[model samples]
Target: MKTIALLVVLTVVAADIEFYKTANDNYDIKALIANATELQAFLDCFQDRAPCSELTASYKKNIPEAVVQACKKCNPSQKHMFRQFLEGVKKVVPKEYNEFRQKFDPENKYFDALEKELSKF
Candidate 1:
């Protein structure tokens, strides 16, 4: 019982240990934007849309935060758009449930690197 309790305590503490590179609450995001831009470019290319640049910029500006009142209202493209948005938080965020998303296949490696890089925002 003591061991289990200790393990639980450690797990909780570990989750709170913000690695220096990945700390957002302690670090400023504006400084991270340069790194964030690279991932955005790659995604913009993958999505192969001209407006991807503008959409990404709007997302960076937090326009969606005002627009997306509910989770379900988030559409497929919006999720796609968000995967691009979370580039700064990728390292901290867990992988998604989608089997197709769980591993790198086709553009998966690229997208994984892309997501990993994106989460730096």
Candidate 2:
């Protein structure tokens, strides 16, 4: 019971921090999945075997841990499909947006951080 409560408190605090940091919609789980969809597609394009073909399909069938974390941070209704166009623009955008090109994705910061933090759980 105590462990569960601690987890909850940690989650709330994390959410608050994200909200304060982003000052934008805290991406929900589905949105995280959407982001994964984008990632899968990109990977598929780069790899000779086409990672997107497998990655996107896998996400549609089974949600990833990153997606679940995103869902926890934001509301369910906020979920949206990931767009390749937005991702493309991110490449040319200023470094501030890229945050040292962390993960080579600007919008993925939340999902990335969530995945890292949740790994311990």
Q: Write the per-residue lDDT of candidate 1 for residues 69-90, one digit (tens) a residue.
A: 2222333344444454344335
Off by over 4 Å in 2: 1-42, 45-56, 60-105
TM-score for candidate 2: 0.23
The global C-alpha lDDT for each of the candidates, from Candidate 1 onward, is: 0.40, 0.40
Question: How many clashes does each candidate structure show, in the order listed?
Answer: 9, 6
Model 2 pairs whose backbones collide = 28-70, 28-71, 29-70, 29-71, 44-51, 44-52
Q: What's the CA RMSD of model 1 in angstroms? A: 14.4
Question: Could you tell me the TM-score of candidate 1?
Answer: 0.23
Poorest lDDT segment (10 consecutive residues) of candidate 2: 18-27
